[model samples]
Target chain A: MAAAREFGVPLTLVGDRERVEAELARHDCTGLDIELWHASEVVGMHDSASDAVRKKKDSSIRVAFELVKGGEAAAVVSAGNSGATMAAGMFVLKRMRGIDRPAIAQLLPTLTGSTLVLDVGGNVDCKPDHLVQFAVMGEVYARFVMGLQSPRVGILSNGEEASKGNELTRETSVLLREKPLNYIGYVEGRDVFNGSVDVVVCDGFVGNVVLKLSEGLAETVGKMLKAEIKSSLLSQIGYLLCRKAFNNFRKTVDYAEYGGAPLLGINGVGMICHGGSNPKAIKNAIRFAYDYALKGVNSRMAEKLDESFPKSVREREANEAPADAKERVVS
Target chain B: MAAAREFGVPLTLVGDRERVEAELARHDCTGLDIELWHASEVVGMHDSASDAVRKKKDSSIRVAFELVKGGEAAAVVSAGNSGATMAAGMFVLKRMRGIDRPAIAQLLPTLTGSTLVLDVGGNVDCKPDHLVQFAVMGEVYARFVMGLQSPRVGILSNGEEASKGNELTRETSVLLREKPLNYIGYVEGRDVFNGSVDVVVCDGFVGNVVLKLSEGLAETVGKMLKAEIKSSLLSQIGYLLCRKAFNNFRKTVDYAEYGGAPLLGINGVGMICHGGSNPKAIKNAIRFAYDYALKGVNSRMAEKLDESFPKSVREREANEAPADAKERVVS
Candidate 1:
């Protein structure tokens, strides 16, 4: 709220106005205006949640998405069910040309800086060509969002050495190594932190696991350190003396530091904020979405789609892809 | 050095004897006992690390292993190349009976508590029986280490539905579910943090990917939080006022909280500490190894092996197992 108010952006509370007002108040954000978009009780916000956009004419999430889609709002921000938001984004705005599936891309913090991990949970089972597409999209996002000139693309595999990992990762690495992008060879899980690859691509199943595991570890480590420090008065005093250094260390590991993740390959700027997100994260997600829109991420993705995968690969997939494979994708 | 002196655990310093002694004096660890196992030359600790273990019989790592093997020391601790440590362990101490591949299992922090993640990076391509063995080993380790009775084993898959995941996870899930242990059907990556499953199992390739990704995310989130806390004076004050709480948060996310991960299924108590471990982590790793020895991990693993897998399955593997596979595995 402070960031939005600092930038002089008009902020409106779309859903449960009282709750939004109370939350803003807790953050001391009264300067940002609030409005209640109270729809008819009979045709309330829930109707707009479905991809069938016609169902709910006044659903809060649907109305907010509509504001972004119709240009009334620069960007839409929501902390609701991600599936509903993704559905509304696609059903109302649709996918970009030449893009087969949408991917959820996140700016993962690394030892060097931050790396982009794509398809975190959007697509569970990914074809080799779809992985290639994700690599291209991830590269572009890194170049724009993270300001990398030529991002290194890597397929997250079990091993860095040749002939390591399962069949899918091995095959994907082969395809990525053949691509024209600054594609590196196979990268292990450690490479994600070592800054060997700017864009790490994996199927959503693996990607989701990686994201959650990292979060869990971070929280665990943080708690353990405090317990250690609290065990003695001298340690507690030592913590206070080096508070600045510890604070510096803390800043490097926070999730809200990177803002929210962008839902890539979609037609419009769609962002998914953390469910327990505060005002600061919400403000950052909006800023990220605006920047993505300003960079024309969708059109650039369309232009780069062909360069990502060869025509031969596409033809092979078309011929060999099972008729029900797409439907078989869990999410 | 400060914590060790306070805790009364005599610490040993390796590498250059004179230089280490000088550094210890510099850090006021002069009272602490220090020893040096000088090699013929400086080991890169990365490239020739494995060779150092294989050829250099008097190297620091080798000496440390011997100390443990000969019962001169309770545990061996080294923050060197994990592959080298694992190699030295397998070659020196060997694997347990009926256990083909030795699994490196680590405890991951979760909301409910810490859950055991097996095969962090031990074996990439694993057979279904290998996973079953991991289940038995994990079940026993959890009972001894985490102290959970009848730990629920959930094979990591793309979905919770039994029929989901790749061929390996699916087959493993079936075998695990049918076992007498508390097999909890199938679980996804989310379940690792969801606190629903006590033991999350996967092939080494997938497990390593998950582990690295988790570490990377924690580091990222931890850093981001620190940065945000310092972005403004208000946040700094908020952070300062909650200094105890913040440090508590920091400890929770730190990797050293749970100490080292034991390379289970090995003949001896071989624990692999993280490469970036500090003195405190080394202490904990030593403590964990002591507990492991006291519990007789190998005996328990050996006891469970013959009964863990069905008679028909073991007979099938024995008949169909490749010659080289047999030598590498069930020796």
Candidate 2:
């Protein structure tokens, strides 16, 4: 909310008016110049997003996505059911032209800032072609959204060797290695935190697992340590003395430190914030959506896709010809 | 170390004779009745386990694994390079009969006690057969080590739907569902904390990522909350007054609360404790190792592998057979 205030974007609350008003009051933002986009109901919980989209037609989540689709809103930010978010974003906002699927690109916290892991619970069965597309989309998104001029892309695999990983990753790695992006062969899970690669691509199944596990680990370890520190009077005093340093360290690993995940390769800007996200995270996601809008990420993705797959099949076929035949085709 | 003393395990100083003697005196263990197992020299920091095995010959780590291998020690315990430990265990002790790959199983702290995530960075490119082996080993280890009977086994996937996960997990899920074990079809990352399943199986690649991320998330959330608590004087005072309750909460989520990961499917009792493990963690790991050794995990794994394979194969083949061939195989 502070980031939104700083950027001077109107804040929209898409939930129950009374509850959201109470929440805004709690945060002292009730009368502090924030707008509410009231929706009568919330989406179904534990139900597939298809059901939500079909049933909850006037739901806040669906309405938010509609606003973005209709260009009424620059972006749609939600901390609702992740599956529902992805479904709504894909169904309502739609995929970018030439892009096979929309991928949830998550920024993971590493010792050296954040690395983006895409398809973080978007598509489970990612084909080789889809991964090639992911590499391109992730690269473009990282450059535009994350401001990395030339983002390094890697296929998350079982090992660093290109031959490693399951069938999907292996096939994807082969295709990625031939892509025009700054492709960095196969990277292991450890590489996600090593700051070696700017973007890591994997099927949504593994990506979701990695994201959740990372979040769970950080929470589990921090809680355990705090318990140990407060167990004794002396340690409690010591914790008090080191409180500032501890908070600093905590901020370094916090999930909200980076904004919400952007649903890359989508036609319009869409971000899925953590369901338990505070106002700060929602604001960050909105800011990200605005920045993405300004940068024309969708157009860039379309251009890249067009270049990869030209309008004329003859030209595409000639370009895709063998290396030796490439000279003849050019001549 | 205090826990070990309390548990009545004879403490042994395994280092340079003079330094060991000096340290023993400094720690007041000189009069506490402990033994000294002196090595010729210290294991070089970056040295391989084989180097320590060959050169120092009596280094603590090497000696401990030797004790387990030679039946001189009930179990080996170490908080060293996990790769090196697995390497040493493989080379020195070898795999148990019928076990393809030895897996490192780590416990993930959930809201409800804890859940076991097996193959947490042991063998990366695990095959379907290897996964079946993991399930058997995990079940035996959980039953004996964790005291959970009829542990629910779920293959970690993108969704709870059986159709989810990669080809590997899908095939493994099919194999698991037909097996006699309490097989749940597929589980999501959140299910790790939901107590829906006792044992969650995945290849080491996913397992390693999940394990580290869980640890990182736990630490991150713990620190964030601690920071929140310390942000205000009133909150700080409240935290101090309720420090005991917080400590109990911390202990609930502590990774060390579950001790260490047992390198299951190995011939001998071997445990891989975290490298950054403190003394309390070391003590707990030792206790887990002792329990594993007593339970004859290796023999049980071997037995389970031998009995489960043909049954699993027959069942899979029967289920997979054409409608006409079904009766022939059954008959």
Candidate 3:
């Protein structure tokens, strides 16, 4: 809603009528092209993503996605159950043609601008081809959405060496080498924050753990700092003096600053926000949804997939064969 | 060397004769009952662990581990190549009886206190049995060394649900439930820093990544704070005032404070230090090694394994059966 007001974009709020109205009344939302669409239910955070989407047919998440599917809304943004959002997206928008699996792409704040990490709780046991598709989509998102001319893509592994990861990573590395993206072999976990690559791809299991661990660790560090500062009068005074610098530091690591992650490879634009997202995060998620739709990232992903894997019989043959023995060259 | 001097214990310094003498001279180790044992070779940081151990038979790491195996030293500690250290450990000390794989356990600083996370880059592809052993060893270390009674053990996964992780985690969770330790089931990555459990067990691949990623992010956050503070004159003054608090915060999160991770499941005590460990970190590592030897952690682990997996034919039969259909009840 804040994004709509700030960007002067038309927005439709889908949720319980009374609750939505109460929230709107609490804020000055006047003169903004905003409409409230009523939904009878909500998917709780602890609820199973697929089960909730299946049961709550008239859920706010479902209703919002319906609006996008019906051409009433260009995109849907939700700071709710992530699994439900992904389930609703797959159920409503469906996967793009030729895309085997969809991935969640999250932008991690780095010393340099940011690095896009994919499969952040989207697919758990990803195959070699699934990771290849993520690389292609991630590259497109990096170039078209993040505005990079050539994005360096890397498979997240235990070590930077090609032979350093588990079976999935080793297989994915072989496949990524065949793609058109600037595949940079493998990157260790430290490289995720070091900004060594634009896109770091991994199975959803590892990516999800990495994402949540980073959030938890950052919060832990902040809390530890506060506790130490308050332990002594001298440090307390020091903390007060450096309050501005600390606040600036907090902003740098704040999840709100990066907004929500985009559910890539879905047919339509869907932004999945952290469940603990504040108003600013919600606003940024909406902005991302709007920008993703405006940029036609999904369409571009489809094009990139087509370009990388032509529909010719030879292309299918190449995919069927072992990655190292591919006859046709990838463009 | 500092720990040996401070603790009034005799110390044997292993490395090149000239380098050891120079280091001792630089550190003012005048009358500390320290003897320098010369080794012709040193394992490079990037050297393959197993290959280096095989080739550099007279390397410092190899000689140090040999001392423990030969009863000349009660324990061995090295602030050198981790891979080489593990290799030297396995080659010299060998795995404990009934232990399938050795693991590295590191103490992670949490909000409340600290959480011990195991298999941090020891065995990359771990079996369910390996994780079960890690749980037992970790629990013992937490109790005997860290002074925690009945430490809660949890498996690190993407979700809290038993069915949420990959095949390895699911299988490991089942095995852990049958163990005598305080098994708390599946814990997500966030729980690692939340201090929700005393021991978080994971495959070495995931554990290593989490360890490195945390270190990298903590450093990144520190760097970002420094940069933000120096961006303006006012913030710099605030930083000076808060410098004491920040230093305390750094000490709290410092890897040196926790010393080094123990190489569990080995027949002898071996502590692995960070490659860039300073004199303080090395001193702490030596202290930990001495304490581990005094506590007889390895002997206790052997006894625990014997009790957990009895040598009776019935116990062997139970181990052979599927996890769900085990005949004999776990003690």
Candidate 4:
């Protein structure tokens, strides 16, 4: 409803009809371009991705993906079970050209502005080639959606040297160096928040770990600050005096301001949001999805990725990508 | 001087003679048991680890490790290039049995107290068995060194569910569950700080990423707070009012308070300090190394790790660990 009021774009709300209407009714969603598309079932967080995707046909996440697949909706954004959302994306929308698997590219608040970190939990067990694709996909997301010209791309490693990183990152580094993107050699984790690079790419496991850890650390810092402020009478008085400054700091670092992350390398705009996101986050996500569909990011992303891969690299990818990973792509 | 005064452990400072002497001369040496060992060469931050390890034989790090190898020194601690330090430890101190590779375990301040996260940057390319070994080594470090009764060992994953990790973690999780330690199920990155788990295990790539990212984020937050405080008159006045509380908060989270990470699974203590460590961090690291050597952590760690790995798991590791990794173990 906020998205409808703000962007004035028609939104097809897909979920249980009663719940959707109840949420909308809380706000003055009068004369808003909002349509309720009911889906009977819901995908619980504990439900396995594979089982949810295959059996829960009428699940909101599954139905939402179907809307995008059938062109009934421009995009599908859900703050639901991400695993189920990812699985539904693959089973319903398929993938883009030159891309073997889809990845989730998330925008994180950085010192300068924002940076894109890919595969937050799309494909956990990625091969070197899969990581390379993630780099390419992340690059496109930064360039087109984020509107950066020749975005500085980097693969996250322990060190900034070429000789750092695990086997996967090492192999991916070799592939990235040959690509046409503005490939920065290597970046440490601190680089993510420092805004040293525009796009930071890693396998799903590392990206997800970093993402969650950052969130946890930020929250912990907040709690720590509050405790420190309350420890002394002067600190409590000082905190009250500087309450405005604290609010500004919180606003700058809050993840809700950034909203959802788009699942890149897919056939359409499929956003994966935080399940506990507030209305502001969901509203921003809807606006982001609307902008993404209007911009045709998917087709351009596919085109750029296809062009980036030479014949030799493509062949190398096929050989390097493990065969067993293909069967285990559900999660 | 601080460690010597506090712990009364005689200290041997290894580095260029002139520099070490000058540093020690700053403080009173009348009643101090301090010895300075001279070295001709120093490994610069940019020098390759292999080149420094193999070519710079008389380098300070290498010379220091040799002191440990020759039984002249109980443990070796250096605030130098971590890669060079790691390589020197491998060259001078062969790994403990049942541990194919030695790992670095660093202590991080948590809400409750502290949590141990291992393989911060030791072995980037790890097998499932290698990760399981890291878990065992981490468990022993927590129990014997950190003095936890039975460390709640958790393999770092994207989610807390059993079906959550990547291929490496998934396989490692299976191995961890079979061990005799107080093995917790998979833990997300957020668990590293919430004090929900005692020990968090992951490949060097992931662990290193988290460690550095945390450092960067903390620094960034500090900067953000300063900027926020400066933006307003009330905030500036409030900062002076609560300055003591801020200083206390800083001390609590400061890395110097905890000191360097131990190079676990090695024959003797090999402490890896941050390159930018201050006098406080160096002092703490020396004390930590002295405590580790005194506790006979190496032998106990070896015993526990060997007991944890069954015949079948060891065989599986020998097969699963890639052949080429054995050749490229230098870095």
Candidate 5:
């Protein structure tokens, strides 16, 4: 309701009708462009993503995507099982033209503003060409959403040097260099949070690990601080005095503020939320989804994919190289 | 000097003799069994690791390894180029018996105490067999050095589910289940510092990123806290009152407290210190290296490898499966 009131975006709550109405009535949502669409079935955490998508036709995630597919909604956002959301997205909205795979682009708070990371648990077994697409999709999000005139893109690796990384990163780095991007060669894990680059692209395995590691580290740090504050009477007194400062610090490192990340390369905007998302987080995700549709980022991404991969990755790998890409390759 | 005095281990300083002697004289070293060994050359950061190993015969890193090779020094510790150290270790000390590749094992402070993570920028490209070796070596370090009777070992992946991993981790998980050690399946990046497991194993690419990400996040959090505390006059006063609590927080999150990690699977004890390590960190590393030598981890590791891999990976891959391993695989 806050999202509709604050962002002035028409909101549609897709879930069990009674539950949705109950939340709206309790919140006293007045003078808001709010609508409700009922989805009888719910996808549980342990439900297999593939099985859920195939069998649960009326599931919340599936029904939400159907709304987008049927032109009733511009975007879909869900704080459900992220895997189910991704699976529903691909099965319903389908992959964009010339896009081989869709990827999840996540926003992380950095020392300086924020940075975007792509392929976070989306395509686990990604080829180098797949990573090339992730970088492009990441670029679009960094530009249109983050409002960067020109974003510095970096590939996540063990070392900063081009000579570093394994077979996958080594190959991906070479491909990224050919793109018309502000490509920084390579970035270490430290660079992700240090604000050295705007977008850090990697295969899903590495990116997923980075996302989870950041969350875990933040929790560990918060718990340690609390324990230390309660160690002595003087420390407990100090905690009371510094409560506001601590609150501000928590907000700064908090991941919930960022809310949902879009599953890019899909036909329409589909935002995947954290399972533990609060009301504020859900509101932020709704606002983000509304903006994603308003900005027409999907069409721009489609254009970029074609312009970047003139002959498509599979064709290029098949030895049928386009003249423009070949010329850039030599240069 | 502190390590020698505190840990009571005889020490040798390997570098330019004049420079080493000047430091010893300035410190008024007396009654300490400190010896200075001269090396005419050095391996700067920019120097290629392979080039240095082959060309720089008298380089300090090479000389230090020589000390171990000749049995003059029980262990070696260096904060220089980590790649150079690994190269020198492989060249002079050599890989241990039946070990296809050696790995660097790092200690990270967890929610409870600490956990060991291995293959941190040692071998970037690793096969499943190599990861199996990393797990075994990590188990050895955790059991012997960490003093855990039986360590809970886990593979780093995107999810805890056995079904959730890339090809490398998927294959590794199957092989790990056949091991005699206490093998927990997949642990996500969150599990590394959450005290969910005693040791986390991964390819060098993932492990290196994890290490750097932890460091970067800590720095980011500290900076955010400082910025918040200085935002207002009230926060500044609060900061003054909470100085000790803040200091305790810093120490708890400080990576310097862990000091250095040992390059396991090498024939001798070689502790690899962080480039930004302080004097106290260096002392801790030196002391840890002394304990590593005294405990005879290298020889014990060899025994473990043979016992675990009755038929070496190469031989097993050649279709000659050992009866012991074959039975375990069926089970």
Candidate 6:
């Protein structure tokens, strides 16, 4: 609400009536044009996203998605359960044409700039085609949205060697080589922080672990540094003197600086913020969603998919033939 | 050699004779009982370990393992290529009676003490039984070497929920529960740094990535802090005052302080250190290898495996029946 009010973006708030009213009463919004939409139910952060989407017909998340699907809003930004947001987006807006699976593109802060890692916590088990699609989508995101000319794409692996990864990564590397993108072969986890590449692609399992592990490590390091600095009077003086630089460093490493992760390959613009997002994070997320909608990322993704995946689509269709027949028989 | 000399252990140096003699001459070894063994070939850091073991018939690594296998040495410690060390250990000493795979147990420095993560870079791809065996081996190391009474064991995954994780983690979690160890369910990547568990188990691919990424991130963080401190006059003064504290912090997180990773599940005690290990690191590696051998960790691991995996071994044997039949048919 603060973000919309400050940015002068016409905003519609959706939630339980009393809670929304109570929250509105807490904030000053005298001249801002705002509308409140009542949602009969609220989805808890730990609730199963798919189950909530299916069971709670009038949930705030579902209603928010409905507003977007009805063309009432250009985008939807959620700081609630990430899984629910992805589930709702998939259920309401669906995947773009030729996209096998949707992915979450997380912008990791690097030494130079930021590296975009895809499928951070979306699809756990991914196939070679899915990874190739992720590379194309991540490339388009880096080029069109993140403003890179030709993003260097890399498949996350155990080693930098072409033959170093497991079956998934090895197979994906072969398929990635067939694409027109700036493929950098295989990159290890260290490459993510060193700004070695613009985009890193992997199955959601590895990506999610890497993302969370980085967060945990950064936090732990900060805590340890603070404790060490406070242990002595001399260090305390030093910390006071270097506090500004430390603050700048914190900003660079902080996830709040990136706002939120964009849910890519979905038909509409949706941004999923951390569940513990502050007002600033939410504001930034709203800004990202607005920019994403303005840039028509989804349409460009569709075009890129058509251009890059003609062979893959055909092969996937051939592979699905028997499964489709089995489905038909079951139906 | 320095450690052996200091500890008064009879040391047999296996490498190119001239180089070993030169190194020995460089260090004062007048009273140290030392013997030099000649190895015609040396394995390069990047060479495939298994291939190097096969082709480099008289390599230093192979010869060192042979000494241990021939009961000429209590243990073998190498600060060279880890893959070569593991390969040599497997080829020369082979696996323990019922153990299917050996794992590299890496001790990760944490805020409160440290956590032991197994399979840091041993088997890139692992199965449920492999992970269960890793837990048994890791638990024994933590108990006997690290001296934890009953170590908390966790299977690294994306979430803490029972249902959270990929197929491998889910299966491993089930197998872990069947063991007699302190199974802590699924732990995320963040949990490893948070010191949430005593032993963290995962496939080599993820574990290797996590370990390297942490090293890279720690180095980057230190560099970034130094750059920030030098950016301004106040920070420069502050850094001087806090230099002691910063050094202490660095020591706490330093990989060198942890010595080296032990090769567990092998029939003999073997250690693999970082290729860039200094004399101090090499000394620590030798110390760890000595302790590991003295404690008879391999024999204890065999006993633990028998106690924890009665059902798993039976099931695995049954599962392997078909493969054995296929091999017989082909033969």
What are the per-residue Cα lDDT tens digits for candidate 1 across A121-147? 547657877887788889888887788
Which candidate number has the best DockQ?
A: 4
Q: Please state the error at residue B253 of candidate 5 in Å.
A: 2.9
Model 6 alpha-carbon drift over 4 Å, by segment: A311-331, B311-331
Tens-place lDDT digits, model 2, residues B1-331: 4545665554444556787677656664533435666656545546665665566566666665555555445556667666666766666666665566778898877655678888886476678989988888888777776788788888888777654578788889877877779887788777787667899998887887676555545554455566667667755765665566566766776767766788876667667888788777887876666556555666666667667775544443222111111100000
lDDT of 3 by residue, A194-225 (tens): 98899999889888889989988998988888
A212-236, model 4: which lDDT tens digit per residue? 9999998887877788888999988
TM-score of 1: 0.67
Error of 5 at A157 (Å): 0.7
Residue pairs in collision within model 6: none
Over the full model, what C-alpha lDDT does candidate 1 score relative to the true structure? 0.66
lDDT of 6 by residue, A1-331 (tens): 6665676666778888898889789988898767788989878978898765798889888888777777777777788888888888788877766677889989988778899999896588789989998999999999988899989999888888876899889889888888889999999888888988999999998988888889989989998888999999999998999999999898888788788998887777778889898878878887777777777777677778878977655654322110101100000
Candidate 3 lDDT, tens digit per residue, B21-51? 7766777767766777788998988788875
Per-prediction DockQ scores? 0.22, 0.18, 0.60, 0.64, 0.61, 0.63
lDDT score for residue B53 of model 4: 78
lDDT tens readout by residue for model 1, B165-241: 76677677767766768888777776786578888888887888878777655655556556655666655664555
Better of 2 and 5 by DockQ: 5
| DockQ, 0 to 1 scale, candidate 1 | 0.22
Ranking by lDDT: 5, 6, 4, 3, 2, 1
Q: Calculate each model's fnat, 2 decimals.
A: 0.35, 0.25, 0.73, 0.75, 0.70, 0.71
Candidate 3 C-alpha RMSD relative to the actual structure: 7.4
| Model 5: residues with Cα > 4 Å off, grouped in runs | A22-25, A313-331, B313-331
Worst 10 contiguous positions by lDDT, candidate 4 chain B = B322-331
Cα error, residue A316 of model 3, in Å, equals 9.5
Task: Give the alpha carbon lDDT tens digit for every residue of A213-324 in model 5.
Answer: 9999889988887787778777777677778988987887666688788888888888888888898888888778777777788878877887898877456333211111
TM-score of each: 0.67, 0.68, 0.91, 0.91, 0.93, 0.93
